[model samples]
Target chain A: MSSLVALLHATRIELLRTLRDGSTLLMMGFPVLLYPAMIWGLTQAGLYIDEARDRETLVLGVADGVDTEGLGDDKVQIVPATLETLDAGDVDALLAGAGDGLELHYRAGSPRSRRTRRVVEDRIEARNTERVDAAAVEKGADAALLAPLEVDVDAIDDATPLVQFLIGLFACAFVPMSIIVSTYSPVVELFVAERERGSIETTLCAPIPRSRIVYARVLAAALLGSLAALGNLGALWITVLHGAVLVVEDPVSLPFPGPVVLGTILALVLSAALLVAVLMSVALSAARTHREGQTLANFVLLPLIVPSMAGMLAVISESSRDVLFVPIAHTGTLLYAAIRHELVATDLFVAVGLDLALAALVLGGWMATLGPTSLIEGIQRPAWLARLAGES
Target chain B: MIEVDALVKVYPGHPPVRAVDGVSFEARRGEVFGLLGANGAGKTTTLRMLVTLLSPDGGTARVNGHDVRTAPEAVRGSVGYLSVTTGLYERLTPREMLVSFGRMQQIADPVGRAEQLIARFGIGAFADQRCGRLSTGMKQKVSIARALVHDPPVLILDEPTVGLDVLVAQTFLEFVETAREEGRAVLYSTHIMSEVERLCDRVAIIHEGRIVAATSVAALVAEHGTVEKGFVATVNGA
Candidate 1:
């Protein structure tokens, strides 16, 4: 119970200290507001787009011999194809065909210009198919022979862009971005900066066990990580809801199938915890001073990013159980799968289980090194650290 | 009360160092005992062991009747360790700093106790200001207040006034006297012979981790004519 209180006090003090720092404040608060503000800006841009779409009509110009039989609706008008006619407001758009290709020219204000071109292409395609069928019948052949194998796109998983968070195929960058942005500064500031300023001695002098102090640092870092993930998630949510991500699909339900998104965010939080352990262990082992700790934290970024790239590669192919054992990368695949609503109970368990186990191992290593004299021992550096500092 | 018996500290190195070799001392309630030593004389190491910051290689140290090695948490609760370099958290106000130490020490009504220390130390004028923004004397006062936030019975001070101006150092001397009058066992370590003469009821001059002389200040003055002369004699292996 006393350890718990000490942990709380340590965490509270850490946050307050970091709050007074301008850079830490920017890191903690920036992402949260940045996403929502970006969404708002994008929403405003989208409003202008929607308003333009409502106000303008798609004018399609056709060249000679192209049928006007079944082109499109009242919003779409098929006009004569000519440079003068197109340029003179005789037509707002022009559709022309080469051997097997078609080009459409339209005023930039028309949002449905592509739809208009597709409509005209469909009419021409149907006419061509009828002509081919007629020629096939004359040759005493079946129309099906014209195209024996048909290609079909089956979207088995139809999770919207908002749901996927653009993370499914590209979980590498997103996952690491969330983890690094959240965990790095807090861990370094709490461990390294405090050590440098000599304020950590007061904390060391407290009657609390060394393990409790480490626990407090881990908790503070995890809190920062969680807040950052929430910010990124909020930004993504707003971007998805406004048709900014997938412009065609309307956002009828947000946090769609709430459990999947929640599960994914929870996975990120777990990843943050895992990252805390890794970072703490690395910083403690590699850093003799605060500047060294900061420099060493940069090395952590590569491992986080590299493994995630591998995980996404595996996820792109079929996800394997072997990939589930790779720490940060596995978490990326898990979070990606969760965002897709394709996560099973085993997926969640393996990812979380491996992460928790990894954290326990790293933390155990840290605990073993901890002693009554650990802080002093660390600060009392050898001649090499001085040489290293001087060289740096 | 504080008791250290045959404490041993061997710092393993290229050539192993016996930083504190078989040092022993005791201080009862209402007494100011001074540890006089030159640089690298194990005064800090001995104090660190007594405060449970370092584990003694042999022998035993007890603070307020609790063995330091076996019962370090109780020792930490009963003793407040201070050094000249013991810095305050620049980011925290004095009140915040004191209350945090209070809570960690398991002091009940930590907020109330912190308030009491704030007033007693005359920190009300800048209690809410960051320690980094305060003057050197202000930061030292806050550091002292933090050490006492738990109201420890034993205070181990290692050169607590090394870099202070005359006034701040004099103020610390007065604080040491007050601590002694209040029945606290104050074990102070310093090279200042004047401090030894003015503050210590008894003085133990340490050289190369062993106590060369341990006796009352008056007795030392009788032998060498002055405390400074006696400190010089003890340090020169006389």
Candidate 2:
């Protein structure tokens, strides 16, 4: 009971000290503002590019043997010129007859030239459809017979299912990344900063067991990291919803995730936060300063990012049960499955259980190393060096 | 009260180096026992063993009647330790640092104890200011207060006044004097000759991680003309 009290007080103190630093506040609040601003900037840039494409009048030069009777639009102007003139930049693209078929040519390097090629290709396609329909009607046949196959897909509520799936895929990678980033500074403050400022000795001398102190630090870091993750996800969700509305037609709405999917994501993100906190504590155990610890903490990103990136890129099959048992990667795969409405109870149970067990094992191993040699001998050589010297 | 018997610490190297070689001593209540040595004489190592911060490779140490190896938690609970290496949480105010450590030590009324310590240590002027923004003297005062938060019966201070200005150092000496007056066993470690002459009731001259002499300050002065001369003579194997 006394140990529990000590743990609680230590956790509270760790949080109080960490939250008092202005840099902690800045790191926690940065994701909230950054996600929304990034989404807005990207959306604006895309809109500007599309508007510029629509407003430009692209000149298409017609070769001498090409038919130019019916291809012109508000954005494309047809003019008679030789191929040499097109090469000289007098026109954005060229249209010529090649072996009974019409060929279009444009400079690959210029954005305007590429845009003109697309415009002219679309116009030519429309003219071919018109000619085919006219010939069919003249032969007393149905024009619709030219194309017979069709597929009918319904939108989930006001948003298409594909849009919802894409959003889910994006969140699968982003939420875990935010959680890992948020835990970095706090873990450094708790482990490295405490050692740097020399308070760790006082803490080690406290009557509480060493494991209890470590547990408290990890708990505080996990709680703070989870809170930051929530802030980032909320801001990201809002931005994605607004972006979806703008990109889609009128009356379109993003489909809100159901309770099960939301719950799975929350559980996975929280577990990831705890796991990250434990990994960081162990990684920074021998670090003597905050800067050194932060650099070391960056190595934790490898295990987290590699598997998640693999899941995102489909480099690893998410449907494989083996992937569901891998740490960090499992969270991403399960999150993708959950969002796609393919998550199963067995997968979640296995993934979360594996992650929590790994965290517990790592914490226990770290706690075993928290003896006087590591705690009081901070001035002496680090433990690894001591071990290399054949000293314990 | 603190009792140590043949405490040993060996660091492995090309051949083993004995940092503390079978050292023995006893410090009773209402007296300041000084362990005088130059740097690397294992003064800090001996004090750490007494406070249960480091385990002895051989022999035993007991603080407030609790053995360091067997009952380390009880030993830790009974001693208040201060050292040059001990640091305050810079982001925390003095009062918060005190109260937080008190609570971690499982004190029944941490806030009340913190309030009493603040008043007793004259920390009221900047009790709420962060330790990082405070001057060196102010931070030392807060550190002293933090060490005494649990009010243990034994105080183990290892070179606690290494960086203080003269006035602050004087104030710290007075605090140690007060601790002795209050019947606490004070184990003070330093190499400063004046501090040893003024504050120590009995001084131990440790050289090469072994005690060369343990006697009263007055007796040492009676024999060698001055504590500094006595320290040099004892250290030089004369």
RMSD of each: 7.5, 7.2
Interface RMSD of 1: 1.6
List the candidates' TM-scores in order: 0.80, 0.81
- Predicted structure with the largest TM-score when compared to the true one: 2
lDDT of 1 by residue, A1-392 (tens): 45566678778877787667777767766766765677677667766665554444433432122333354533333443322233353422121121122222222223333333233334333443354335444444444433311112222244455446564544433544676666777777767776677766677678877777776777777777666666665555555555333343234354554865686657656555556545554444446566777566666766666776777777767764557777777776776676676767776777777777777676666557664245233545566754544426
DockQ of each: 0.55, 0.61
Model 2 chain A weakest lDDT span, ten residues long: A147-156
Give lDDT tens digits, candidate 1, residues B42-74: 999999888877789999988999999888878
lDDT measured at residue B40 in model 2 versus the true structure, 0 to 100: 95
Candidate 1 CAPRI-style tier: medium
- Point out where model 1 deviates above 4 Å: A1-6, A28-172, A243-246, A249-253, A256-264, A318-322, A369-392
Task: Residues A266-348, candidate 2: write the lDDT tens digits.
Answer: 88877878998888877766567766676667678667777766555551344545567677777777776776788888889
| Candidate 1, residue A142: how far the Cα is off, in Å | 27
**DockQ, candidate 2, vs. native dimer:** 0.61
> Model 2, A81: alpha-carbon shift in Å?
21
